[model samples]
Target: MVDADQTFVIVGGGLAGAKAAEALRAEGFTGRVILICDERDHPYARPALSKGYLLGKEERESVFVHEPAWYARNDIELHLGQTVVAIDRAAKSVRYGDDGTVVHYDKLLLATGAEPRRLDIPGTGLAGVHHLRRLAHAERLKGMLTALGRDNGHLVIAGAGWIGLEVAAAAREYGAEVTVVEPAESPLHGVLGPELGNVYAELHREHGVRFHFGARLTEIVGQDGMVLAARTDDGEEHPAHDVLAAIGAAPRTSLAEAAGLEIADRAHGGGIAVDERLRTSDPDIHAAGDVASFPHALFGTRLRVEHWANALNGGPAAARAMLGKEVLYDRVPYFFSDQYDVGMEYSGWAPPGSYDQVVLRGDAGKRQFIAFWLKEGRVLAGMNVNVWDVTGPIQDLIRRGTPVDTEALADPRVPLGELAGRD
Candidate 1:
């Protein structure tokens, strides 16, 4: 049990770690809170990196979770630009980088989030190639995009995931040619499935973006340490003033592994294994955010979510659990993305191929719709794309596990809340 004299150590400086600390203080714990962050910047919203911030539509200062003064005022020791090299479980302490300063903890929370998966292709180390994860990367990419815009240059994105697509939209907004290469038939096919993925594919196409589907990136061609072009398996050469590798993200779990926490073995769900309350195998250690995989009562399987909402909600839940308070953490996973004029919000788990079919309430042609994933006439998950003010009803349906009439669900005239019996 946490007491006033104990020290609480949080290993990540992202939204999750920051929220956990805030929750502790709000709960009147009065314990020592030490937050260790590898980034030089203060805790900030990472979602903005591929959105408004990357497009220069938002200021760098605006993305921070707290102003520098907020930390000092709250009496939270904020360690910036310092890496936690190792966690000594027996010693109940964590070692820092190089200097090896050890910080002992009564309770430890590992919120180390995920990182972008890198490609092993040739020329990947060339200049002008980038990955979007940190503020530093975003600053460099912004400058590159600006230069490309002036030269009317082109960008070859290596993947068609959310980050890649968002960056493509931003690059195009700057008036640069964007070509997206994907091995799948459509962008986001793995997440939203082909029908909805086609919607995004056509949206990009209509905005003058090029696509090379079912192709493999052979090499990134460069000269004088600068990227000039990229070649795919189809032997097609695409201009590449800059390249973004947003293939996917892998959970940062090295510390969890080294500290003897139970690691998940799933192919796509590898991370530290935690219970429903976010407690790890070690009683004194807790894991949350992208680095932790916990069993979802709704999904009936271990799930590791990498999105803003999971980190936002899970942080406080983990904090409560750390304090020996009751925490089930049953909140349905939710996330949103902005690409071009399309704003999409998705809730709940559809678990690839688990849903029988997708029912649409609006027009995909018009880029305004609500797509519901149904399993045996029951709504399992739902997504609203460019459709306003209905997430509450959509999420309620999935949460309550209530069956609905397909005919009424596909009709836009019927209020979503009425169908969920909220009316």
Candidate 2:
């Protein structure tokens, strides 16, 4: 147990940081806990900001993780609108902003998370071009959707990732002409592989969303201060009223790097290196959520997963570790996305070049199916479209590393929960 007066300083008040603070209180470590957030509002959930919240299906107030009174009742001091500038490891304190107000901490949890990567192409700074990352970004895009009057304006999504597809669905729901530009052969090609990605490509196409596969955007052009069109490398130009860049995100690790922590070099981007326990190079300083590159047990390599599940799970795991509890975080990674009236859920690890077999249960055309990715004879990962019930059993089988009959897996009559008994 930590000392009653021990100070725990948590940076970034996103889901990860907020959950960590809540978890600490729930776990009965009632020391002085301070949550430092650059945003003025209380901690809010971000997942719905891209879908339900953007579409007006969910209220903005409902997105809050906790009410203000909840924090006060828990004795969790919130330092909202406070930016942590740097960490003084030697002094065991963190400096905030230009004023350099130092906050001492016995243990520090870095959940700085990530920011949306911006396109460097010309006309990217146009008024109609935007990137969806924060609540404010979504609010601005939602306002643009209102001003554009759905059917009259065109929405051009520059990336085919989850966020882009989500926004595409939202825009389409509002009767906007939507087109998604992806340089890959299929949407989500990098994550779901070509075969499964084709399923998404077909789904989007059926919903009247145009796809420009294998097309690289050369530049975004604008008329006056507003975005107008986008030109591709193949010399093809598409008229666009609004441009959404969803290429992906980069870890927000500048503060940690400035604090003299060793940053991990990632092929896709940079992140903080941490052990299985989520402890950084400095034991006192732990990192979790999107900013940390964690070791994946199934893939047998370090990976950085930017998802709501990762942030929620990793945050609490790091908090427990900071409290001197030894726990190895090796749960199967899971993520979900909603688009065009379909809910897509995925679980487990998909290592490149490892999967040799993919068994499909149910028909993809019907938009209700479970695709199990198998490597050798064991389940590596599984993706479900409009089938969340099957994910629970598939995730269990993946975690257990169980082998199943490929024929049985393909049979829709066979309950997926029974697969574990087959082993």
Which number leads on lDDT? Answer: 1
Q: Residues 328-386, candidate 2: write the lDDT tens digits.
A: 98878889998877898888877446688888888888889888889877898998998
Tell me, by TM-score, which candidate is best: 1
lDDT of each: 0.90, 0.86
Residue 384 accuracy (lDDT) in model 2:
92
Tell me the RMSD of model 2 versus the true structure: 1.6
- Residue pairs with colliding backbones in model 1 are none
Worst 10 residues of 2 by lDDT: 143-152
TM-score for every candidate vs. truth? 0.98, 0.96
Candidate 1 error regions (>4 Å): none
> How far is each candidate from the true structure, as Cα RMSD in Å?
1.1, 1.6
